[model samples]
Target: MKKQLHLLRQLVQQAVTHSDNTTSIVTDSFAVNQAGDLLMIKDVMIDYLQNLSFSKKPEVFIKRKILHTQRECITLLDMLPRTKMATPDQVALADQMRKCLDELLRHLHQHNCYFSCEVNAPYIEIQRITDKTFQKMTVMKAALKRKKIYSELLNIICAAFDRFHLSQQHTYQHLQYMSALQLSILKLCEKASDLDFDYQLIEHLTYWCFNECHFVDYCKSLIKKALKPHYGTKQCYEQLCHFEKRLTVQQEKANLRYSVQRNSVKYQLMVFVQAELECIEKKQQYHSGGKGVTLKHTAQIGSYRVQTSFSVAALAYFMKLLCESGIIQAEPRSQLLAFIAHHFQTPRIGEQELSASSLATKYKQVTPRTAHAMKAKLKELCQRIDDDFGSGD
Candidate 1:
């Protein structure tokens, strides 16, 4: 028992050390790489939970370790950036960590139940300990509830808006969309902060908005229509009315489906984890090997498919330029590369077909000499485009 307690203490210390290291790294840098930091914390917490699970130690000892781990996990959760600014990968990782912490608490509760039944102490003494433990657990659970609500709401909003794309030229429309989204989110947050907020209502609304209505596609179409030349206010209002009618029809259909499947264990589980599963699928696609389609083929850009071919390094450089310009926003270089590789075909460099993963790896090894030439080429392209635009006008 002594050895087990000692080992558990060491695991907790290790996790705490990792959490501190992650915090320090974020604090020291403005351009903190949250995905990597969050991943490190998640791995450490999982390791702690695994070690705690395998122990045959006394419930009292296990409870201590669980509480310590839970507290540390909450600290790590608090350290995460606000959901509005956090990348999708970071949000997913934080959600995973939250699940791990919940599992740990569940384990702790099981231990408490066993402890109450098995301990030979006076009945009142056991009752006091159990009640105190429950109280602490309740406090920890409350600390997590607000964060969970924010994360869930953000996830639903993001999913609904993911397909709504606009070019940089449409600055007015872009600002309006962003302002509306921010305002809606702010209101949702205020409501969620209230003590009497109906969390179940949020859950049901998320399901209805995300699954029942063609929400993403709907947003995309709405934006497209609103952006068309000479699209007046009357047309915009009529379009919204049509959308509402369609939404009502879809909601009715959704109600029938929900009534049928809401009680099913498997259906409920699927609905609960749908977002996580989609995130996993996206990651898998990002990391998967190429489809053997070379860059000689056309790639889709907006409504048009244009044929283009560029070497891997040239393409990476172009993507970097796009990020540097305010034309598009992407983070952490790897995501940008993956986006390019996913849309464009695999480019062959020196008799080797460079897949998405390989493309990212090769992009890093690009010498400064090669980068200079790519920069010059990009500048030349920009000049040509400018000349053509001037002539056209």
Candidate 2:
């Protein structure tokens, strides 16, 4: 037993050393590395410990050492890049770790030392124990399926989040645990179609997804604001500031950029629009007239731009020109025009509606051509809306 403990300690040291020497970036062929070798040694130890059939009392000191080594190995395994463990060797070792974790939990459970509600253990810690234990009891899985564990973990996580309010201390580790719990619950769902999940877990997950979806929608709207045709430096700067604040808030909770892949389009769009806005701001402060910049209508759009200024209408017109020039697609052009028209509650600029000239005077300067195109697009969109959802007079 002492010899085995020595081997385990040596393996852990080797694994930790190899990991420290390696770069943080995980590549595809990591399984062939020395890190993989050390991990496999730990895997062998797990198997050896699991196979130990004792008729007599297990040595208390030896058991303590084994548990300590198991913990270090678990931590090291977690620190290893999950996505880089694609190779068979690395993958096998990972599976072995999970198996070992389950065995350890089982051992503790049989000895009545594993389950304690007093500690208020973090969800990740409980998850590590419960997930493996459930996996081990595959035959009695349905009966062993514990809703209390799921509910308890959720309560712990929610309490932590509420207490700290997502500041630096409460974020990274909490998010890591939340993400792992989400993945584990999802996997459990996939395994048993009839398995009932706790309502708290469901509600929490739903809220999380809804929050991310709202952020994505908000980003889309912000990009539209930034790209509006007559938008000037000041407006652009203000919009950028608003978007940055929201991004900071989201990042403080979780890495939404990584978790919500569908919102990547919005992220890319925001980045592009922000860069353009910064350029516009610099140009406005340096080269352009302040607060009263004016430009003549370069083109006519059914009297939409009697006089042009930089504003949302003008911005839409600018995007129309990009569309005409094949710089942007027709679908996005239509969408932007529609968005502006809906928000401003006007389809075209006229004597009755707000004049483009007045808007330009108040806001920033916009090219006449862009304003004209924007109004034209808006008019077309209004007519289409009338065709689709017109009231019967």
Candidate 3:
């Protein structure tokens, strides 16, 4: 046994040296460089011999197998991209390699130590022993048909796990078990399916392998934002700010354009009203200057309401315009004063029926000339408001 241990140490020391020296491990025909490296690597595999202990030798090989198998798997996966789109032959070759690995793993596990796998749900840990519980759970998932026999398999596997497991605090954790061996085995089966193997093996093997490895966390910490594809590139955030500024500038330009267009339309309407007013003035002068004879007329119909509605409706909107056009003067109380002068003077603008109380009292405060001046001003202001505003700004 001492001789075998010494031989194992020598093999490990040599293989580590060779791995350090070699640049590549494969050739066109087969592996020509790792031949010497492989021999040294194989010599260190102590679990392959039949006389090895279930207690001691299995643990040593477990550590070495973990390291060696990892290196070999990486080497093969790397070679895949170099091979032109995978052929059936290439897929077969990859499967053959993995199967060889599985056989080796089973052989090494033959002498592994045991612990009590017998227990109920919410598994009770026995002596902090083997990962038999995890393994059993993983395997039971794959074997739905023979659930009754699974309990016995669980106990046997647990006994082996107890002997192999090391303390969590121990510096050497080579035999330390994983928490989710089932998940790792599931992932492994997925990998095998990619190599064109039958899927049936994965479902069953995953159950058994669940007793072996741990499930690693594979989630990302951040949630990705859903943005335009351009946002994914560098410098896009700064460009987005610039685009926002340009949109604001365009909106301001549109508002200014609308205001200018509105003012031009008002100027045209005012010109038409002025021309019509000029024609009315010329016609009125012609009629008044020529009339010397009295003309017979009929009695007016509904004459009582004439001045009230006329003065307020026609003059209310136009009075303010006339005031602003220099046709009249603007002053406080000018609108009420204008109504008094016009109604009292010409066309007897309104009926005498309205108690002159409100108009008379207001007119008493101002002289006749002041009253006439204010009346003209009110009319001009009314005209200006009509031309400039829909409601007046």
**Model 2: residue 167 alpha-carbon error in angstroms:** 32
| Candidate 3 worst ten-residue window by lDDT | 215-224
Q: Estimate each model's TM-score.
A: 0.25, 0.26, 0.17
How do the residues 86-193 of candidate 3 rate in per-residue lDDT, one tens digit apiece?
234333433333333334333444543321111111111222323554555545445422322234334543444454454332111122223333344345544532
Q: State the displacement of the C-alpha of residue 290, model 2, in Å, after optimal TM-score superposition.
A: 11
In model 1, the clashing pairs are none
- Which residues of candidate 2, in runs, are more than 4 Å off? 1-4, 7-68, 71-102, 105-238, 248-251, 254-278, 288-393
lDDT of each: 0.42, 0.44, 0.35
- lDDT per residue, candidate 2, 1-393, as tens digits? 345445544433444444455543333354345344545554565565554433243667445554554455445434433323434654554454444444543443354332322223333354544454335334333322443334343444344333333332222233444445445455654553231234323333433442344334443554564446535545556555655554444322243322333544334445655676566666665676554332222234323433334355455456445666788654323233433443342334433444433433322345667666667867988889889999456
The most accurate candidate by TM-score is: 2
- lDDT for each residue of candidate 1 in 282-386, tens digit (9 for 90 to 100): 554565652322212233442232234766766666665566686755433454565455556433443333466665655556668668878788788888998
Best of the two (1, 3) by TM-score = 1
Q: Which of the numbered candidates is closest to the native, going by highest lDDT?
A: 2
In candidate 1 the C-alpha lDDT for residue 316 amounts to 61
In model 1, what lDDT does residue 53 have?
Answer: 60
